[model samples]
Target: MSNHSSSTISAFGYEIIRDHILSSVLGKHENEVLYWAGKELARKFPCRTIEELVAFFVDASWGMLELIKETKDGRTFQLTNDPALMQIGYRSFRLEAGFIAEQIQQIMGYLTECYDEKREKQQLITFTVKWDVKERIQNTIPNE
Candidate 1:
């Protein structure tokens, strides 16, 4: 199969697992479990830079991730999917948020967390990744 076709099939499978299977299996703790799972995934596939992080999301078929803003303590990112793909009812973005949090923590060497805000009307998600500069970790990803 062509790469594009393979990606489409992968994305379809991802939706099935993410929207239906995971929720059914995880039940009420679905979000929490997925959040931690994302963190674990990040550790396994670490990204050293924001560019790599953005590319990782696309390569993983998660979504189109764009860094929309940055501040002293945090960064804001927007995640959007194709309009046709937005029909899926799964509203949870916790997994993506957790992944971003962990990636940022490793990259910045600070205690970091991410919160996701769903804009259903806009069919997009906004992630606010915040870090405490004071809470630095010793082993950080070196800049490339």
Candidate 2:
């Protein structure tokens, strides 16, 4: 095996690589691409319950995920962690926002959207994921 495969990267190391790619490689389109990438990831790792989705975030080392509030239309999630070694910004969480949006869209069978707000002082990020009940996802294939 290659030395790269033999060595394990720490969470911080992973964050650094992620940040570099988002900022340097993706550049201006980082947020947009990351959001789509996250949606694609959600498609791959579909969750049946909110608990499973939350657990996935922790396992992925994204941060501590918590459901702060929920309404008939949507839910809000709070993700917080120390600012040491990670870039706290809008782009940083777009992937997560998209992931949550897609997961909810699939589970609720509605058109969902997600946006995030960053509290720099608190080192906290809040994602508001919502969908209009009236805008349901149409089934493309008929049940056979």
Candidate 3:
């Protein structure tokens, strides 16, 4: 028999699965779980630079990722919908937040953290990622 199970799904099917996971399986824990899932996804697809990371977002259907600001210790990224983000609320973007945090942390060799700011009216999400320079040279991961 053919592998029908591996067939491509329509956008409707995609939304159905997303909604189910958000409203049923994940529910209140949706933010936390999805964030960690994003981090794990980053590990699977590590990017060496900010440009590659932004491109990865576009390729992954997460919308357009743009670097809006950069500072000594960190940067701010704005994720705006190229078309639309399906109106999934701010919590949905935590996944992207976590993904970005891990990617930057890995690139900069620092312990990083990220949080998102929602602009519901504009359908934009901003992620502020920051890391301390002191933490970079510290004993973060110990020998096992």
Q: Pick the candidate with the highest TM-score.
A: 1
Per-model tally of clashing residue pairs: 0, 0, 0
Superposed model 2: Cα runs more than 4 Å off: 1-11, 89-91, 139-144
Segments of candidate 1 deviating more than 4 angstroms: 1-7, 10-12, 84-89, 142-144
TM-score of model number 3: 0.81
lDDT of 3 at 34: 82
Q: Assess candidate 3 and give its lDDT.
A: 0.79
Measured over all alpha carbons after superposition, the RMSD of each candidate to the real structure, in angstroms, is: 3.0, 4.0, 4.4
Residue 85 in candidate 3, Cα distance off native in Å: 3.0
For candidate 1, report its TM-score: 0.87
Off by over 4 Å in 3: 1-11, 86-91, 137-144
Per-residue alpha-carbon lDDT of model 3 for 31-113, expressed as tens digits?
89988988888888888899999999877767789999999998999887643344546237778888999889888889898
Among residues 3 or more apart in sequence or in different chains, the pairs in candidate 1 whose N, CA or C atoms overlap within 3 Å are none
In order of appearance, the predictions have TM-scores of: 0.87, 0.84, 0.81
lDDT of 2 at 60: 74
